[model samples]
Target chain A: MKGSLSDSTKRVMDIKNRKWLIAGGVVGLFLLASKLLQAVELTLPRVPLADGVDVAIEWATINLAPFFDGIKLVVIKLLVAITAFFDWVPWIVWVVAVGGAAFRWLGIRTAVFFLAGLLTIVSVGLWDHAMSTIALVSTSMVLILVTGIPIGIMASRNDRFESALRPVLDAMQTMPSFVYLIPVIFLLGSGKVPAVLATMIYATPPAIRLTNLALRQVSPEIKEAARSFGATPFQMLFKVELPLAVATIMAGVNQSLMMAISMVVIASLIGAGGLGNDVLFAMSRVRVGDGFEAGLAILVLAIVVDRSTQALGQRASKETRTE
Target chain B: MAQEGAPKLSVRGLWKVFGHESTGGIVPDEIANKSKEDMREDDGAVLALKDVSFDVNEGETFVVMGLSGSGKSTLVRTLVRLIEPSYGQIIVDGDDILQYSEKELVDFRRRKTSMVFQHFGLLPHRSVLENAAWGLEVQNIPKAKRLQIARETLDLVGLSGWEDYRPGALSGGMQQRVGLARAIAADADILLMDEPFSGLDPLIRRDMQGELIRLQEHLHKTLIFITHDLAEALKLGTHIAIMRDGVVIQIGTGEEILEAPADDYVAEFVQDVRRTTVVTVRTIMDQPDLKLRQSTTPAVAMREMGQAGVVSAFVCDEEDHYLGMVSFNGAAEAKQRGDATIADAITVDEYPTLPADTSVESALPVVLEHHNEGALAVTDEEGVLVGTLLPSSVVGAMAQEAQDATDHREASAASLEASHADDQEEADGDGDSEAVDPREGMEVS
Candidate 1:
């Protein structure tokens, strides 16, 4: 099985000499193939994948209307409650509360940044829209974590479930955020509820994936130690596993929040009232100044939430390590 | 648990086999003789424990010792059912714990025994006090009471001022102390320690061993301590069990083990134990009948010395306070000169002395180099003549150690044969055992 040193050396020498020739040949083959294809008049083929999706959507809309309606009822109630709560708060109160939270979690720099960003939103006359978007993002984030964590825990407990979830999460991540609206609209029809659904669908994968990862990454030594110490399965989960996994799970929540905030603009397509709707409306009318202000408001809101949540995650991780 | 007659813990016929249930009930004869890995391949079972049986007495430190992959860790962990054994009966305080129900097992663990992990199983997120209080927390003790107990336990482990510090922030030895504190804070009757000091530097490990010995005196919790280090085992163990390939090769007191190793595996491990440092002069000291009184005549002393062989003799006072050495030639000269007593003719400066408790291993060298005058006299605290140590006796002691080892090997071989017979009988009876008994099989069918 052994190759003599000289033979191995000669093979290496041969490969080095022919490498450039091989590169040329490969390029030549690619060019020749393209030329032949060109002579054959390269054309795109039509596929019925979209039509199939449409038919499925149509069928589901008719047959699953009551099921979708039940979901819609729950979704609408939660969305309205969240939005109404934010709308009831005064603009100055919103600015102060957010600024204070940012200060507490992310330190002074982001607090200043948050206040500046909110004040700019008010100065640009998009205060109400920013509030509405914050409501949407916060509600979606809460929903994401609530649903994602349990599924993540289940996946952590079973290898098969985790494997099954990996591909679906990948697809959710790679599929365009706007494409989520197609199903959302078909099921709930254009409104804030549909937008929330779309935002949740787009943003939820990272939360689930990361939570699963956090639980799986827990050291078996620590796990065994917990069990041997007489912790019940439930106690082990709540006491040892969750505490150890908190920092990683917090990172997941931070990512979910960022994903939710980024989807706010796209959420406007289905008539969700937010900075996204303002930007959409401004763009439709070609009002550059209005578009710029609305876009700037979204950007500021994303940065403020993103920075604060990230800092919270970092703080938790550091505390865990130090303890 | 407070009973007087029952041992603190007793494990019998314990076996832990890791893998699928396909080979759970049957083990082949060749597989039994094979190494752990080969046996695993043969039957798809990692035999982590095999016929491990040992008794740990109440308030005693029973150390289980073996090198890595020697199944010592498995043996200790299986006692607590951390890594559950495939078969065994763990009796603690006259209760067969293997038959404990789910709730009963939980209660048994919470109430009966606690463990100190090799890696120092302090919760990473908990402070030193919290880690110590973890057992009580799981027991659902009230917060204030648990914290109070934790604070006291930390103090007991010599971590009084550092109670508020995180375990992660402590040194390795201190972290293990925290681990130890957790076990003690539980107030369990027994503590199972799995190489709790293996991660420490040598000095720190040694310090921890000293601390453990001191703690054991006050706590008196029946501790099943596991370690691969022979010195640690010897220093701390009241009784030690040496294990190899899941079987306990021998179990005896520290001195018994030093004097008699059960097999080559134990002999090889104990070879580097520095017996000289541990074995004392008291063990090898011989009481010869040739003690010469200071009042005895020089001519009589010469007669006694010449009778013994030819050499100097130890001449002590009537109360046995070692005074001086009396040589045969000096006694003969005194006899020729008509000296009345050996006291005047004694050679006090010639013989060197050694304390009774000096290690025979170290004392032998001193005796070999300087015993030209006579046998080295060993004295007690009051400078009284305890006995004499000779070069021959010191060499004889080593020879005795070798001979004891041979005797132990024979005993162990016999015990192994007997245990194998018992195991074969058990396997035959337990072979492919189903949930339903054969008598009940008719009903099931």
Candidate 2:
């Protein structure tokens, strides 16, 4: 191996050209194939996929749509209930809740930053939209954890299942956020329900991925020690593995919340009303000022959510480590 | 009664072959006599242990001492089924542990035996108290009660003040103590300690060894310690099994090994051991010669001393209980001064007495300090004269061990050199008189 790749110049040149070679080969083959063909159909091969999806989604909408509607009703009701509670909460209470939690978990500086950010969001007259966004993100986050953790745990214990889920999860995350809106809109047409559903599809992957990683990352030595103590598999999972993996799982949750909020702005394309809607509307009309306000509000929400959850994870891991 | 009857742990025909999948009803015949390297090359299997068997008596520290890859670790782990044996019977309390179901194995691990890991495998997220209480918690004991027991066990391990601290906050030795505290907290009858002190520095390792021995005195649990340190095995073990190349080379007390090593391998391994510290006074001591009854006259004492060609006689009671030493000069002076019995003339606590259980290393300085005086009296706990350890005897034992080891090494070294010379001469003279190694080359010339 060393003899074959001895010269540093040759190795670096090989790597540098490798990327161009792949791109050039692909482009050259396509052009060559196209030129050689007598009658070329340049219409992107749809494979009747759109119509197929349309009919399947239509059937699901007509037959199974009621079940999803029931689920949507419960979800929206829960979201609305939480939204009402937050709406009833004076803006000062949000300040205290965010600031107080930040104070203990992070520090006085983060708490002060949280307070100022909340004040700014309120001053910009986006308070109601921010509250609505918070409600949607919180609901999606809770729903993601409720479903993601068990799936993650099950996948973690089964190699074949996790392997199968890996590429599917990659597609869920990498596929355009707008792509989710199509099928979602087909099932639950043009509403907050479809929007939240799209945001959930975008956000759920991180929770499951991180939960699986956290469970796997738990020190094998501790697991063996737990076993040597005659801990039942159930007791070992709950008492040893879960507690040790808590910090990592919390990190997963923080990422999920961030994903949900970011996806919510894209989610607004399907008639979701929130600060995300403001951004969406501003983007359509090119209203720079309105877009700035809604975008800034989202930033403030991100900072508050991201910092608190991150600080909570750091605190959990630190308390276990330090004097 | 258990100690006298069935051994605490009895292993028979135990074998652990790593990276080898044996599917047939018979073990490959090559493994029966071939070297580990040969098996690894031909069969892609490592014979980690080969037909190992040993018994650990109840309440005794059974040490499995060996160099690395010698299967001592494998043997100890098999006792707990931490590493499954390929084929064997491990009997604990007359029940074959190999036949235990998963549930029964858990029960056995739960109630019968506990292990102290070499790496101090305490839960990093848990407090010292919680880590110690972990085993008890698995037993479904209530939180408060388990914590109480854990706290007491921590106190026993000298970590009482750090109960609330996490394992990461403690030093290596302290963390190791917590591992010990965890095992003892479970209150198991047997402890399988897997080189638990090997990771510590030499000083800390010695301290931990002393701590373990001190704990062993009160606990009296059956302990199987795995170590490469022969001195440690000698210091701690009531009986030791020395292993080499996955085979038990010898099984004996430290003194027994020093007195009579079973083979050259055992001799070579124990050659570097400091026999003074490794051999107890009980093994080195001879039956006391200058003995006289306490009521014997001073003239008679002087005569006994004269007969033994010593200056003193150890006076004992009628039951041969050690009273004190009566010096010939003192007794004769007492007789001149009209003293009646040797009891009155006897010197109390003369010339540094030692218990029979004390190692010669410990008794050396005391005996050498009073070398001009008669040999040190070796007594039992009941204050009876068991034997005497002379300075000459200690020196002789040390010298004899050194001589034997040096002579063996030289003899082997010379024989090897002689064979090489003969081979060189043969190759130069006839070019084919010596048998050619098939592994070296095919052509004899």
Candidate 3:
């Protein structure tokens, strides 16, 4: 009597129509809510919390220093050691390593940037200093990864832990670079230790935040499936959850590396040695040419580290996708 | 072969509550303290599972059929202690598994059971072989032995050559097969499947269902399958448990459940069951008992039909092969017109003949489509007439069966209530005189 169609066809049509309406409503509601929220925020008067209660920045910086310093020292030492090993091997080894990394990450053109950048540093007689800087960033990244991942996992599992850590992460991400120096200068005192400490504090938030987010984003269905198969909590974490979140964690590492390099230059103001010190010294004497040279050297160092780490992250993702 | 002993798995009085306002968190108030109407309205504390109990007989396909959020998945999970029940006892082979510690639970999972999920849950980073071997490896089986077993299992599921491909490289159906292969390789006694074929295309789903049936026929492993598809339940389940909300509404054999549904919900579920696909010809066939006459001429054909007391006759050639049919009217018309040859006038391939092995269910469609007046002839492979099924007879048989089913349901419900009232009378200590069956009083229906 009705439209003599199959029941399944009708069901599918109904589902599609429902999905379309839902999508439209979601978008419209999101725009309207944002507009309303913005208006409310603009109309509301601003008020500051009690002066002593504003401990977000202070606590974040204080907690961040030791971790950052530990990272910087590890990076510098590793870089120096790697460079010394490379110096003994044939120049072709360097070519191959950079070439392989370049091809993997940003492709051939960026690989050229990588090669040219390295060559320029060598040509300018700043290879050793560049290696030390490279070492500092790598070491910082390693420490950050080791510490941040566990904290992230914990935060993801416990809602209270995550909520408690939120303000600290926010403050670490937003605090001025110069403000990081005030506390580290008082506790660790100006030098490589303070500078490393400062860089760690500046660079750790992204890693922690990303790790937490990645772990949280893992599909509940996947976890339930794993559990039903009799995976112990620990086994589930290592074998299922961590492996699934590998790509996001790698991206977090890339962010951390970028942050560390930016901090390295700022750390130079606290009397930490490297291209930062080189540029700072050049600037203090009104020597524009020397300062420009040192600045270029820092740029070269940043590009090499950024490309290599990014390439590593890309490789991890590619391997994951293939599986 | 049915084992004469206790079931392989048994659950008793399982309860899981969430968001309860309590400090110690040790006990839950009895559901009877609240009325059915109040329970439906109150959303404060969600009761995921409430006094759910069942026994999974060894080597039998016990299906838990329920819609999403009906606690079927939760029930399965709790049996394995994936989500701990607030109050319950699970006896696996007569051992109270609910008392098992963490390590003991791990040991139980490793040795006693394996699960297949709706989403397949194959490790995305591992090859098919590696993924299949994961469960064995977790139990510390030697890599070589595990891989060898994994290979055999994959071959069993028709994925022998794709062992090196990751789950991402395979289609959804193949991935599910791989998941199945993984569970089989674990060599667990009980296999728990939670809507394992729900995410596949209809054709693939049917194929997988057939594959599972074939596998079960060979292996005869204990299976507790959960699905929302009524058709799948009827096809695979030796016994089906229909659940609603957080409780099982009915548990019985497929035929029993279909013949006499427990309630309005189950009745509604089976309302659209296409009888054409479910009934068989054996249920409707009648034995042939009539005199036969050899007639080649139109006048002889009329005489034979008049003597047989039937509407139609199966025509045959000299070799005894089926030709078609000759109706009484046709024979009489030819005789009156002075047709000399009955063979020349008889209709060839005029009658629709179905095989004896075919279900009355499948034949209903063929009969309806062709608009046949009466029974279609049944034939053998050699095209010899075996029997005939009338359209009127099938319709009449089906209507009678439906009526009987309804009557049976009502009788069963009355008996169930009577037994429940006796139990309540025994439990009454203060002589309140209010009898109630805890199960009947449950809000599931």
Candidate 4:
């Protein structure tokens, strides 16, 4: 009986070996066939996918000219207003306000870190560029929030919508950030509006994904308890689900801010003026010192924004958490 | 719309089959008729609740008791339509809730029923007061009024000072108190508690059980409680339904189930229950062997006691209000001393009197302290003498229960053996063989 078991196993091994032999034979036959056909050049006719995309973009540019102009005008006005506001405020006042907020929510150490980071930007003679970059990132974040949060909420509620959204988010995150510039420049033209529009496309996925994940992660018992109490769907979402998920959603917002900051240099390639413009100018001329200065200022901004948003997320969670 | 004397909540022919189909889908007759195990194994479906029906009277605590997977939880959830049943009627105050629209169902839940979860399903983000007010909050009550009501309910549940604290800060027992306060603040007529204390420590669980009993004393709400603990079921339930394999095996009071179980399964289920804690004196009390009137002389009481072959006698007034126990020897001593009446002979202060409704466990100490007299007076709520209880009698009743259970089990096994013999004969018949006479081959053992 022992030998019988081993014999059956041996038979199984023989079958596996035969299967591999057959696979190798098929591969060899394909290779031999290809060698035999080498005399004739065989090629597939290319699909006109690139041409089709170009035609679609051309059609949208011509037919949706008014719609694109309306969006561009709104973006220009918002950018001008925000840039003017930053110009109007003294650098010290901006620093003090941010530093005071950091002190209040995060503590003295974080406050000192924020003050040092801001003063470094001013000391390096990149204060104007830094302010402009802040303005652009702020505007992009506003657009992202307005669009991303609602989409996230809808995805959380509907399974089919969530499934459909998953692949689109995957594509948005995984595709090269540079690719978004072409479509925006083609539609909205080359300026701050296109830059802002490009940043919106690149940075919005995290906000939608994190918000959906947070809402979906709320405990089933809590949801059932809410429902058993006869809460209308609206009440359940507002009173129970959103309140619990606010911390994680704030985390999504933080991710969006970081993504917007990272997009600043990329945004400058399309003639959007900011710290990104300084860095891009230095790269074209090969001025290492100027590029390093601009890069340093961007780094300081990213760190301060990241830490501040993180602190905000932490504060939200603390407010909801039991002591 | 409530009809005259309609039950507060009535569930009829409720069926919940999971993994069968989507909502409002009918289970095929072939699938429905198969046993739960077979359906799960062969059809990739679960019979969560099968043909379950029960009525909860107003102010009665109806306990659904089962081990895990017996579908008691599913049954309770179906009552509120939290888990929609495949087929059922849930009539609440004479209106079928199964037929309600979404709005009407929400209205019914807000006004009528509130559930307490075993896991204390409190909003961790909300303070205790806010959590308690949640049911009302969803109903859109004003904040001030709801908070006031919540504060009062917290006080009722002994959590007054902890109103502002979050649920996570509290211990398991205190958290469940918050759960209770939440349900109470709803002021719903029907409170559904799904194994509410099953997650607590044993000591804390006992305290919570006592707390619920205390609340129910004043609240008198219609409670449908689910529990796997038999002791908890017997202690809390006014009427209990025992479920197994998604089917109810029996429904009766604790004493009725203890005394004459409907089937062998119930008999076996109740075998481990300690009768001394569950059986009340009312169930085990007997008519006194001898009784003496206060006006009767000691000589007359002694003669009555001797004639009745009892060592002790209960003395009562002309209206049968219990006086005290008068021992035969004491009466004899009084007669020899030429006392005027049996009043002096009656040992009133030494013997302990028990209320007829008190459990034997509660009366055990007093019974033991006065076991010399061998009997104690049992009286109704109004102090009218009803019957007598003996310490020996309690032990005898408990012993009799154990004997009866054993006898019942033996009888059941014998019957099972007889049925198996019949089955064997049928199998033998399939082979075209002569059917052996069952009695001749049956072993006596």
Candidate 5:
């Protein structure tokens, strides 16, 4: 029985192999014919989409200057207000407040590290630049999270929306951060506005993508259980899906924060002054020691933000596991 | 047995083909008529459920039993519209729920039924109290009231002390208890359980089964349970529907299914169930061949025993209450001794009498130890002699079961051959007969 079965299978395979060979031969012949007819050359045509995009951006800049200026004014005021608040506070006050939060959410080790890091910034005489960097990043993060998390929620609920948003997000992540500046510089002009906008464009994808993934990964059985109890769509999202997704979303927020910090030196080119300006100044003057001091300040800020946000995510997950 | 009044839930002509592709989304006559295999082979559509139908009366534990892939899980999910039926009517309380609008369906799900899943799908982020109260919370109940009700429900399921613990912290059986509490806390009319204990260890599974039985006794909620384990079905189900290949082959009481399986498939499925546990003494008892009044003289009793061709006789009073067995030798000796009546000769001390409703498994040892004296007297609840049970009758009942099994196997083998011949004819004498031999081997063995 097995022998006959194998024989029939072999015959079927032979027929399939012959079919493949015939198709391959036909394709090979077509390619050979096309090569022989290469005298009739095919020329490519250009559509000039780049010129069209330039025209569109110029039109928007000319026509929507008032709306763009209003946005610019609001962002500048917000950034100035935050920077003023940081400037008004004594360094000890900032240290005590950030250190207290670190202690409560994380533990003594993180708190001590944050305090030591803050003292190092003060000792390096970069306290003002560090505070400006913190202000700019925090404001950009607020904008990123407010818009990105909701977009993530919407994308998570609908497949077509996610599919449409996927390529846009891919472009946002992969295109050079300088590419974002060309358009922002044309419309809003270079300043704190373009700097914050560029930072947002750079930092928002991780939040949206990770939030979508986290919501999708909140176990199907848990969703079904919620549905079986007749939870309305809104209740299911808020009570079940969001609560389960929060930890991963916190990780997304941490990524966004780190991305925002990575943009500080880049943002400095657009007159968003901070430690990044210090680094850029040092580089322009060929002062390696000054560059290292500025870089160390950014590093300290990144570590503090990364550790705090990760601890928060871990706490959320631990709550779900052993509440 | 309490099938009084209208049924609480009715399902008629339910069909759920997973990859259904008939035009207009209605089940096509051709696909519906074709066998499950033919439908899959021809159309690439799986027939997950095929014309399934059953009624669940109020407070009845209607168990759907099948092996894995037999669509028992699908049937339970379809009850709550978790998986929409490809076609059918699900009538609950005079309302065909298939016709319910979105709002009405939501209301129905909220108020009329609750489902327990095989995986004990509790929310991991929630405490046991909040998990149990989730059904109420979704309905927009106030927190205080819902928590109070959840507390009562957890207590009912014997989890009162652990209400504040997270579900991840509980053992599997206890987690399922929380699952049960969550379902019961909804207070719906019908409860659907889809193999809720199948994931537990054997010992915990048995414990949960007992817990469910106790809860059902107290609550009396209508239950539709699904399980692949036939033993679990028999133990918990008031009525069982045995399914095979997306079709319900039989629906009956446990004893009925055991005694008369509906088809070869059902018979094969039930072949390993220990029959003694399900078969009762009353089912196997026999009419007493001889009877004597206690007032009869020893000579007369002796003559009666002789005439009846028996070693002993059951002596009863005028009211037909069983007295004892009187052997022919004892009667003859009594007659020689000039005893006035067989009452003096009759002795009640030898054999233990069994109630008519005792299970055969419980009666086997009693009969084995005492059959030499005479047949054991089978009495009713009133102590009136109803029938007799002997060693031969026990053996005969079991032997008849074995004989019927062998006969079924032979019949099945014959039918298999006939079908194989038909297939060959349809294939136009194609020499592809090897595929049918393995099934033939299975049936014969």
Candidate 6:
């Protein structure tokens, strides 16, 4: 009796005593790393693989060019097509999508703000450009999720691979968005493709990092319960782990979408036309009214994507808890 | 009911080792070169389950009782191939299940067995009915038919009207019942429950246990239940297997385990059992002596029974049919009522009655429920009393058994220590032995 404690009591005490300090340390480290990287645009010099590797570099760049160019053309063509289709569809569809999401997540007041934001953008005559911006953001998100989730799953499955990739992910996330354009432009040249490539590099870290974090955070008890009931490893991942990690991964997607949207204006430097191009053109021409209108359009687009994804994430988490 | 056939499930020499280096080196030369202990120690492996074996008979409640980390969970998991054993074979319905392919394993799981998890792994996105139909759906059953079956199963588990609610809206016990209903709906021959009631409150746990027993009585499915609680094991198990450190220490009927534990660990388990309820009249019944003088008076009956050192007197009719039982206190209380007629004065229905065939476990709940001093054993269907049981006698028998076990354990420990001391003394008598010679003035306290 003196030494005995019920299993649940011990488990509760263990949870209460869990090391939240480690989480704090990780956040502090991230902030410090970000500040340091920002303070010094530190770049490591690349050594050529051979004595006369200039020819190889040119050959490699030439070889990789067609693929990047093809990707660029496809992305821009898809964006233009989506924008044209948006003009045909009633504006009410966009409003409903945005408003419905807001109502689900943050209720009526937020839903009103969502409608008001869209109305403000359209009233300022940037509706077409905003729709174009939405196309770009959605495209980038779909691409990132497709690539990032598998990579995250691989990283979670292998400790050495995950550890090796951790610092690379951190560097990509912390480095300036401008740095992505340098290599992307060299490979694909200035276009929507280079712009999307840069945005993908900048926005992808959260998806991978959060996927890994969420999978690791799943309780061992839940996993054991699944296994005890004859769930195969694949079944455990698809049925239990994936469902449980849906909220966190969706949050990652939301962050990626926001980052992608933020990169659109920066991406305009390479002829990635959208509301970003309008904002850049208006600013350079010193047209304050035009710049404000484009800026408002971007803001509206950001809010719509952010709210909808947030709503979806909340619904997923709520469903998980109910199950 | 015991069936005259092979067991439904049989596991033999099962071993599950995690993180073992030698697992990949299964070549004959390598295995022959390495000793078992050397391989085990050098590989730094954890033997989650070791040389464990058990057979679960058809239509019987088989309980695997062990504390956490005792390999009870591991053993159960291996039965379903959830955690595949490194060695040993599992035979289900007389076929080796270890040879099953991926598709075959899935088929086996869906058709032959279904499991209830402790945490109630209901699909959160699905409604209760949908969750219940999950297993049937996995088997490729059509949606409409599966839903109908799921609804019926939900009704069976007492969730008939709550089909639309998700698992979160329900309480913990209700969720577990949903888990049970889902397993039952699968219509598998074997039901494997891994500590299903462990998470519920005590009252709910008892209710669920009762529900399981009731369901089992009607359906007669083979059940493999795992629990750490000895009380639950005794209550639910037709046969209990007590495990320790990845090994089954004992496997027998509940009475065999409680009455005759294999070792100290199991003795400690049953030490705190409520002996008055667990012990039965059949276990301590004395033969009837008809030659004794018949005293119908309550006061006379009390004196005669007390003098005879019996806890109760079995009253019989002229045809030797059991009429009723009168305990010493019942007779004494009757005398205090100031009624001269013995039939009017004596308290006839003071104790519960059961047939001799009733299990100690089944009788326990009845006795405890009624708060009866004892139970009477009857022979005929018309409640003909055969013998009387005293609560005090059951307690005395349990106390005596416990004392004997304790004394035996102490004696064994003493003998072991004495043998060790003797060995040390003999070693000290050697001339080359390093000995601390006692000083003449030193007291040998």
Q: Pick the TM-score winner.
A: 4
| TM agreement with the true structure for every prediction | 0.77, 0.80, 0.69, 0.83, 0.78, 0.72
Worst ten in a row by lDDT for model 6 chain A: A221-230
Q: Runs in model 3 with CA error above 4 Å?
A: A1-96, A103-106, A321-323, B1-4, B20-29, B35-43, B275-445
Off by over 4 Å in 2: A1-70, A103-109, B1-4, B19-46, B282-354, B365-391, B401-445
The C-alpha lDDT values of all candidates are: 0.80, 0.81, 0.73, 0.85, 0.85, 0.74
Consecutive 10-residue window with the lowest summed lDDT within model 5 chain A: A314-323
Model 1 C-alpha lDDT per residue in residues B295-314, reported as the tens digit of each score: 99987887787888858778
lDDT (10s digit) by residue, model 2, range B295-404: 88888888878889987778889987877788878888888988788778877755567888776656767787889886788888888889988898888876876686
Say which prediction, candidate 1 or candidate 6, comes out ahead on TM-score: 1
| Rank order (by TM-score, best first) | 4, 2, 5, 1, 6, 3
- The CA lDDT at A205 in model 2 is 91
Model 3 alpha-carbon miss at residue B9, Å: 1.2
lDDT (tens digit, per residue) of candidate 2 on A1-323: 77776787788899989989999999999999888984865566558878897898889988997898887898788788888887899988878888898888788898888888899998989998899888888878878889899888988789999999999899989999876688777777787777777877889898899889989988876787778878887998898888888888888988889899888788777877889899988999999999998999999999888887887898778754423
What are the per-model DockQ values? 0.37, 0.35, 0.28, 0.52, 0.45, 0.20
Error of 2 at B125 (Å): 2.4
Which candidate number would show the highest DockQ if scored against the true structure? Answer: 4
Model 3 agreement with the true structure over B226-289: per-residue lDDT tens digits:
9876677767887899988788989997656766789977865554343334445544666443
Off by over 4 Å in 5: A1-46, A64-89, A100-109, B1-4, B21-26, B34-43, B286-357, B365-392, B398-445
Q: What TM-score describes the B chain of model 2? A: 0.80
In the range A1-323, model 4's lDDT, one tens digit per residue, is 99999999999999999999999999999999999998998899999999999999999999999999999998889888988998899999999999999899888998998899889889988999899999999889888999999999999999999999999999888788777788788898898999998888889999999999999998888889889999999998998888889999999999989989998999999977899999999999999999999999999899988988888788789877743
Residue B65, candidate 3: alpha-carbon lDDT: 87
**How many clashing residue pairs, candidate 4?**
0
Candidate 3 C-alpha RMSD relative to the actual structure: 16.7
lDDT of the structure predicted as candidate 5: 0.85
Error of 2 at A71 (Å): 3.6
Q: Which rank order by DockQ, best down to worst?
A: 4, 5, 1, 2, 3, 6
